[model samples]
Target: MSTFGDIFGAMRQVILTQARLDQLDVRMTRMAGDIDGLADGISLLRDRISRLEGIIEGAAMAASRQQRRIEE
Candidate 1:
């Protein structure tokens, strides 16, 4: 028992809602890509930090040996 204007109004609302949903989907997809990029960057940074720590440890050991030699 709906009039033409009521039907048209309902259709318009449905279209607007669908468009909003589509826009949200696109934004979420982009956000997911950004998160993946950030994860990759973080992993790379962790690896570099680990390498630097190893180098520092080696230097410390060498310095300790030199100090011991001097004492003797």
Candidate 2:
């Protein structure tokens, strides 16, 4: 036979567990948003890097042409 005190204690434990779970859910949601922001930042960096690579390649080609003309 379960005593009333035991039943109330169990109920209290259940409530506390649920509260903790809710807190975790909120934290997870915030973390997901942060991750999304990071992903956007990474994408922007990649685009800038690609543009810089193109500029560097153009400069290299121009230098090569100038060198060939000088050697002629």
Candidate 3:
């Protein structure tokens, strides 16, 4: 029932839609990889911050003890 022009137009639309979907798929995959990398970086930073916090706490405790010894 469709005319030739109509059929051709419909096929063209489908092709364009498929191309767009493929491009989007590639972009989404790259974005997912980037997000994973960012997550790893954040985790590393958190661990380093935790270690630094421990060092700071230990130093503060030691200074307090030294001050107490001097006062005594």
Global lDDT of each model?
A: 0.99, 0.99, 0.99
Give me the displacement of residue 23 in model 3, in angstroms: 0.6
Q: List model 3 lDDT by residue over 2-41, tens digit each.
A: 6988999999999999999999999999999999999999
Candidate 2 or 3, higher TM-score? 3
Candidate 2 structure quality by residue, lDDT tens digits, 1-72: 469889999999999999999999999999999999999999999999999999999999999999999999
Q: How far in Å is the alpha carbon of 41 misplaced in model 1?
A: 0.3
Looking at candidate 2, the ten consecutive residues that score lowest on lDDT are 1-10
After superposing candidate 3 on the true structure, give the runs of residues whose Cα lies further than 4 Å from its correct spot. Answer: none
**lDDT, model 1, position 29:** 100
Give per-residue lDDT, candidate 3, residue 70.
100
Which pairs clash in the backbone of model 3? none
Q: Can you tell me which runs of candidate 1 are displaced by over 4 Å?
A: none
TM-scores vs. true structure, each candidate? 0.90, 0.91, 0.92
The Cα RMSD of model 1 versus the native structure comes to 1.7
